[model samples]
Target: MYKEFMQWALSSDDSWAGLILRLTLGLVLFPHVAQKLFGWFNGPGLRGEMQYMTTKAGLPVWLAVAAITVECVGAFLLLTGTGTRFAAAGIFCLFIGMILVVHAPNGFFMNWFGKVPSGAEGFEYHLLVLGICIVIMIQGGGKYAIDKLLQ
Candidate 1:
């Protein structure tokens, strides 16, 4: 069972699936980051949201800054597949922190609704991104990724 699971998870084929995952995660997350960094797409912008996260949400300023840095600026790296593996690592850690620190109080574990489990406020998306990041990390960026050129 373990061997089969590892085999499936580590398969080298990353064309369609990686393309879909990369596009979807990047597009879905881009707006949120923009909202935090810029006022794009009816977003709150960096100053406002980061302030709120610290004051209203009681988050440490550094953590808030890190979130802003990762979600907004770091997202560009992920989208462009420029240093894809490292960008994915940042995103994965960010999501993990969000789950443990922010959402866990709402629920201890993910609400197993789909392949990538969700939480009280649609953690499904984060989990999906996490899975995609994991896949991409192991297989590396595919087709149009900058990693290909570098390699």
Candidate 2:
């Protein structure tokens, strides 16, 4: 079982497409993770995020912590092309939750012009990220990935 799991985890193609998708997703996610984890980019950081999640978002402390951990660790894994599928899966689920919980009422288009009364954006960005994650989950990490080395 362990061997099979490892094999599946390490399996990947040699195409550049995986590399491109992996890097794009990784890079895009990094700043968001940093904001939540390190307070960078004017983010609320750990404590603030926790309070908001538990209060405004009405999430349990454990789920908030898990989400933060997944965002931080998953972004790093995606960047290195290590555990690409797992990382992508985590991110995919995270975005799905975000869309359903936060963005669904705002509709599909982003509030580019601040026209929305709620000032909340839509799910278009989440959908795009979800699409990227689906591709990465299917293709694995492509060229220059650590998964290739492990295999």
Candidate 3:
């Protein structure tokens, strides 16, 4: 059972498409993870994010923590091309939650020019993330991936 599970988890086909998706998505997510985890890029950081999610967003502590952890850890996994499908799925779910909880109320299109003044931005970015997640989930990790090496 363990062997089969490992085989399934670590198996991946070598393809440039997968590699491109993994690397691009991973790099894109990395800054957000750093911002959330270390307060880089003037982000709120973990503690501040937790407070905001709980108080302003009404998310549970556990959920907020989980979101942060997934973004941080999953970005590494994606960057390393290890468990690409699972990481993509996790990111997909995270985007869904964020869209439903936060971005939906803002309507389509990002503020872009501070047109909304104080209103939140739209879910356009979330849709892009979701699309990328779907692509990665379908393709898995390709060349240079630990999964491919193990396979």
Write candidate 2's Cα lDDT for 59-123 as tens digits. 89999898888888999998999999999999999989888877898889999998887788999
Candidate 3 whole-model C-alpha lDDT, 0 to 1: 0.87
What TM-score does candidate 1 get on C-alpha atoms?
0.75
Q: Where is the poorest 10-residue window by lDDT in model 3?
A: 5-14
Q: Which candidate order results from sorting by lDDT in descending order?
A: 2, 3, 1
Candidate achieving the largest lDDT: 2
- Report the alpha-carbon TM-score of model 3 versus the true structure: 0.92
* TM-score sort, best first: 2, 3, 1
| Structural similarity to truth (TM-score) of each candidate | 0.75, 0.93, 0.92
lDDT by residue for model 3 (60-94), tens: 99999998888888899989998888888899999
lDDT of each: 0.69, 0.90, 0.87
For candidate 2, list the clashing residue pairs, or say none.
Answer: none
TM-score (C-alpha) between model 2 and the true structure: 0.93
Cα-based lDDT at residue 58, candidate 1: 82
